[model samples]
Target: MITRPRIAAAFAAATLIALTGCGANTGSSTNAAADDFPKKGKSIELIVAFGSGGAVDTASRLVAPILEEELGTNVEVVNKPGAGGQIGYTALASAKPDGYTIGATGSPSVVVSPLDPARGATYTRDSFQPLGRHVVDPAVIAVQPDSPYQTLKELIEAAKANPKSMTASTTGLQTGEHFALAQIQEATGAEFAPVHFAEGDAAAAAAFLGKHVNVLVGDVSGVTDLIKQGKARVLGVMSSERAPSLPDIPTFKESGYEVEASTARGFSAPAGLPDAVAEKLEAAIKTAIEDPTVVKKMEELGLQTSYLSGADYEQYWAGQEAAYKKVMPLVQKKD
Candidate 1:
């Protein structure tokens, strides 16, 4: 007989079974969605871990439209600049592992931020899945057009004679410019008081142009306009070879200083992103980076196109991490 108690128990059992089935279906649906990434209408967010109008943001914006066309979805470039890219890196790492949220990752800020416990960065090298690399912007040292230092050698000698007398602009503490400064100090015993602009290259360049700083330690992409307009004079490029964009400027190597540093920009998704979704995103990025229009645009901005696929991109990051770690002590801010 189906008594009241028996009926209640039967109902409970049915409810449990239904809930279990719903759970299984939920997981299956999630897997299916990941397998069929983009889903036709959902837009992808491309986080730029720097200020707008800066090199990273500029690159992200340049590629967003191409990525949108290639992936058949909107690619939104969101700037989350602050704390020398710590805020954006944390945001990118904390995002859901779904491929919808990817970020423009650059070194050595992205690599060295987590390495230093002081930065308290929540994300490490493993927090991201590199999709593809875009460019390698070589660093440059520039002074006012009327500055006394005409050659890199003259600037180094003056800085060596009066350590920390000259003020140089860097994007922020422990950024690419700071690292370049450290490399110069370590190699040549020249020290310039670093003025940090956490807002990114634009701010740093502005400070230099406004005469707030004596020298500008920035990337080729950041100062390309100034260099072309003759508003600033480049002392040297911190690259093995003379940057094609600044072919007239001499490299640090040419000046007998062994310092080569450049910032590599790329796209990366949150770690644990689904394999199918990651593959799709990687392929889309590869296509966008290789587009002729994109290539020309990057070159016009003084950014050299250096494309690397997902696996190779990750390896590049790994190598950068190792290389930066060795020099971390040299560039870390002293308490």
Candidate 2:
């Protein structure tokens, strides 16, 4: 019914329309996906399992502005504290795969809850898809600069000689720092009066500085502040080797005890996030972590910026799971 000239003109007009309208086409799933992703103008929820003001919360807030710039929407952090982070991880697992809901979580603990049934978890490693891992904060055993114990050896010997005579503070019960404490007991046969604080590392630092506790097990990121202020002195690191940031500080291994531990922080979205959308989020996170400003901020926060994307992040978590499985027994509260 139509001549060749008319058909050619119609084809040219359609081509022009498609180019002008962002390549949208009826029944074109690719075009639909590209447009629908992030659903522009919609906000993304960032979940922090612990209460406000902790390392995870601070890291999430820093990344939020960067994500907002990249994703073109507000990134809101929701604090849902319960059961030592099980509540938040459960919410992340149960969230729809639409890529709107995301969470910042720590390794060893993230891996801990799912494997340790005592945590009463509803999620597994497969629950949420990891976007990327950004930070690895090694743990440290610190004391007040003017404490009687000059070295880790002196402190352990004293604690070993008299159980509960010396006190130790941890961020929480069965947390990574707590686990490190357990390892100290296992390795050195020391008995310390373990104190729990919901305020996490900052509280750990404060307790030791205020002399509320004789010793504090805290993340390198958290303890660095105290060290810089000349309030606390690190006795030993829990990691296998001295942290590059603290070259002079020796690890438990280097100090003659075997304890390798650190906290890894990263983001993840609900399971089954469409690959396209997940990739977008991953790229944004990677870019943010690599930014000079972000890098400087992380250094100031005492966090080491280590970006591990997708499979690399998963592999790291799995490795932590294996290591923690072996170390979990050390942390049991002896009920």
> Which portions of model 1 show Cα errors greater than 4 Å?
1-31
Tens digits of per-residue lDDT for model 2, 1-335:
99999999999999998886764554367646845778867899998887787788888888889988888888899987655566778888899887789999787667787776666778899887999998988888887888888888888888889988878887666777778778788878997888877555656666777788888888888877678888889998887767766778988887688877778899998888776788889998888778888888888877779999977998888888888888777776576
> Each candidate's lDDT (Cα)?
0.90, 0.81
After TM-score superposition, what is the CA distance of residue 172 in candidate 1 from its true location, in Å? Answer: 1.1
lDDT of model 2 at residue 7? Answer: 98
Clashing pairs in 2: none
Relative to the true structure, candidate 1 reaches a TM of: 0.91
Output the lDDT of residue 21, model 2. 76
Candidate 2 structure, TM-score to reference: 0.85
- Per-candidate clashes, comma-separated: 0, 0
lDDT of 1 by residue, 141-243 (tens): 9999999988999999999999999999988878999999999999999999999898799888888889999999999999899978988999899988988
